[model samples]
Target: MKKLNMISMSLFLLAFLGCRSNDNIEYQANLDNAVRKIHSDLQKELNTDVPSLSVYIVSPKGTYFSTVNGANGDLMTRKTYFRFASNTKNFTSAAILKMMQDGWLNLDDKITAHIPGTSISYVPETSDWNFKYKDQITIRELLQHNAGIYDVTNDDSAYHINGQTYTDYMLENFPDHQFSATDYVKVLSQNNLTYGPPNTVYHYSNTGFSILSEIIARVYSQKSNASKTYGNYMYDHIVGPSSKTPLNIKFPELASDKQLPIPYIKGFIKYADHNEITNQKNASAHIGEGNGIGSMEMLSVYIRSLMKAENVLTASSIQQMRTSKGPATTSNYALGCTYVPGVGYGHNGATEGYLSTMLYDPETDFSVIVVLPFWDLRNMNNFEKCLTTLNVTAMEAKKALEY
Candidate 1:
């Protein structure tokens, strides 16, 4: 009787395990189909001349990637590298937090305060330009975009030297110019371009991030007594340590380093009459803000590790980075990350030729990265359609994970 009972119990356990495994398989299949549908729908709706569109989703169930090549016939694969642009902000934020964790700096430290054991200010004091509220802005304010710094890249007013906006003036006149953080600050001061007092408003300023990069370099240099660029510190400390496998992501030290790795997705700038290949444009002008280059797979892995607190930053620090401050009008931006309602905490990137979206839902441990290889900067209708597709892809990915 005992032997018969044991056999029956073993059969029951096997059936239960088999049913669970089948359920998981069904869920994964449904997710893959949903991702495929998203890619198909995007191609049909956009109807634009783009080199490629790719979506990568990582979930507990499995990983799903879908891509569609356009008329250019440049195939975009998981290994194909692309410029991540402003997604580098998240990395910058994480590096700052890591430094904080190491007791090198504090979030509330004033930017004008002298570096520990050094007379140099957190931001180098300069007679070249005057910075408003330089003494009042804290590290936290910059991280949260509450510093009210004038955004030379996106601000519309005259940049004093020319009738055109700063971005237009620079791109047309100095497309290959290598700009430093101090140069950006000088432009802001000379133009008297400011949003208002620090901690009073929320304006997305790439210039503020450039300042943060400077602070990172200064703080590390003063603390360690070793000269290191922001990119070097990041590679050696943050990005390098987090990855279990080698990642190809890199912060280009020079504006002339425009060529991406082999098997890279080409980017295009669409005009009314024709498309221009912009894969070789200088990224130095947007350093520390929008100048990261790497593959989608590497980005996915990095972000997942970041959100999971796995070999990157502590879970508490990650939570702090995701916590939004200031008024409700701040656009749900937290530190260097953005909260996309149901999508998760991540950052988006847009340059002249590429638009990318990244989101990681901590609740579900799901991450979605979508990259489109073309951007129509002048055409609002086309740009809006592209943005809409990215948002939809994220929502669908979240829904698929739930399923």
Candidate 2:
């Protein structure tokens, strides 16, 4: 996923060029030319076969423009659903922040306080059992990726250093494996290792967010006295609340028989090789890690609503979500959202076959959403470049509209 901050120097340059005003005929012509150029160049430049790309930009005044390009089946429609991947973290974090705003919990609450036994919850003692600082892990630390909790998903590259990754282990050992967030935490807590002691460095951990999902579910369950899954909680409270009528965004359940959500585009394990893999069975594995699925249009609208702080969250909560918990100089990450100094706030997520991003700038009320097949995990540079190009395209249009 392209998680890097996207600062739109193009918008500044366009302004420097003294572009025509938004209502002027020349401005409209410039906008059309810019969009056409962006689309054409992307068609030629993105290094992928059977590419499925969706880009949507919404301006402050509520006007929007969007396009879908690529060869993957069904991806051309706004109704086709795609995996949000780690972008799910933004939903997770928003939900948690909302819960905090509603007085359900505080950011500083210790994880063990809500999910008892988590501090001592370890697996086999021989291979992993050291919870020296486990009790100190807090909700804030986890949100900030400073919890020092061992990440099960992409921990130290030495495969199985702690244990097999959730995806690899389940795919090979038990193809029918169903994920239980609670169970995952129980097992992961056992491998008592920290990237460094808490609050030391920013080590992205899907594992930490998974644990947060479990906490969110547990907290909601306590209040309602009804079963609440993490995915359901986010849809009901976070995404759904922000959605406008007819733009409903829902969490997709893996069909009982393990089929991709109908009307979904084909995603690949390898974009270059087109190594397509079936993923419905694994969709439920980690709701927090990235499983919030929806159509590109629905996602775009829903995210714009989020940025506007509609009915979904309080102003204070939204501000909290956008405030960085890291070092003073860097705006790399806020609570659930990532940030660029003068760009926007959001996150990018990539699972095995999908790549997605959502960014919104409250100042300009501008938002950009990109969902596309992630062809190569090793090609971070290219991915970032592709995303930057899209950002420039979107911002340039926003500039035109702003006039």
Query: Backbone collision count in every prediction?
Result: 0, 2
- Number of the top candidate by lDDT? 1
Overall local distance difference test of candidate 2 = 0.64
Error in Å for residue 224 of model 2: 1.5
**lDDT by residue for model 1 over 1-403, one digit each (tens)?**
9999999999999998898788667655665676667656655666654566778888876777777666674888777888888998998998888888988888888998877667888887776446877888988888888998888887766453467667667767987777788878988777677888886789898999999999998888887779977887777787665544346678886767888879787788877788788788677777789888888788898888888888568899988888857552358898899888888889989877888888889888888898887876557886777767777777876676563
lDDT of 1: 0.80
Q: Model 2: how far is 170 from its true place, Å? A: 2.1
Candidate no. 2 TM-score: 0.77
Q: Which ten residues in a row have the lowest lDDT in candidate 1?
A: 239-248
For residue 348, model 2's alpha carbon misses the true position, in angstroms, by: 2.0
Candidate that scores best on TM-score = 1
lDDT of 2 by residue, 19-110 (tens): 43444555455555666666566656655543545566666444444454545534446567777778878878878877787677778877
Off by more than 4 A, model 2: 1-50, 71-75, 114-132, 156-164, 240-247, 252-262, 271-274, 277-281, 327-331, 377-403
How does each model score on TM-score?
0.90, 0.77
